[model samples]
Target: MLEQVSLFVHSMWELLVSKHSEGLYNSVCLAVLLVLPLLLLLLSVCLCCQGCCGRTCCCSSCRRQQHNRARRKKHDDLWISSQPQPIMMESLTLSV
Candidate 1:
């Protein structure tokens, strides 16, 4: 099995490198050239989506901002709770 695998690999390498395989080599190169940019574009789009679509990315700034937002909310809640409430007043008509 190992010998068969090695023979296959050796034959493939020779085929790829031989002068008779120009068409095969051109096809392989064309495929790589065409696919590489698309793969890179996909990777960039996925990364951008992860960063922009309310998802956690591989950065500390978003985490820091999240913590800051939570802290601000907590502080605002405490401040609001501490404020005086308005008293309910009925009609105060003076009797003549």
Candidate 2:
């Protein structure tokens, strides 16, 4: 087991060294290392803003919906009240 572990570590080290010798791998690693923190920072800021502003954003939509509902209710009430009542007809006589 010890020998196997050492062999695995050696192989991994060799692979890393070979990739690093290519130059591109190192640059890629450097770019990822640099960009990763910036990305994480941006993500944290976005999450913080969302947590802080979520309620306010939701409240704005809620207020708009409430306003629309109130307007719709008012319009509906007016429309219904404006309709004339149906007159009752005692009978309809048709003479041929």
Candidate 3:
């Protein structure tokens, strides 16, 4: 049984080596080695974008823009309210 298993492994290795010498096998291996990582990177980027966008994939930029606009509006409102009002001359004269 051990001898049979060893022979099977040897035969499989020889077959693989022989196939590697063929251009088709090498091309397939090269494609997998090169394209697989690019495919995975693209997939990861797409998934990350989807997650960042929350419920919608197409509105990530739009949502970010809206958030920025809302934040700016809030800041502007706060700044306007925090400014000191100018004193009228009549009121100042009356107070004195």
Best by lDDT: 2
Off by over 4 Å in 3: 1-22, 56-96
Please report, as a residue range, the 10-residue window in candidate 1 with the lowest summed lDDT.
15-24
Candidate 2 has a TM-score of 0.40
Model 1 quality (TM-score): 0.35
lDDT of candidate 2 over 1-96, digit per residue (tens): 999999999997787777678899785896697699999999999999999986575567788988899999977775455668786676656679
Among the numbered candidates, top TM-score falls to 2
What ranges in model 2 sit over 4 Å off?
A: 1-22, 58-61, 66-96
Cα error of candidate 1 at position 66, Å: 10
lDDT of each: 0.78, 0.82, 0.80
lDDT value for candidate 3? Answer: 0.80
C-alpha positional error of residue 7 in candidate 2 after TM-score superposition, expressed in Å: 40
List pairs with backbone clashes in candidate 1: none
Model 3, residue pairs in steric clash: none
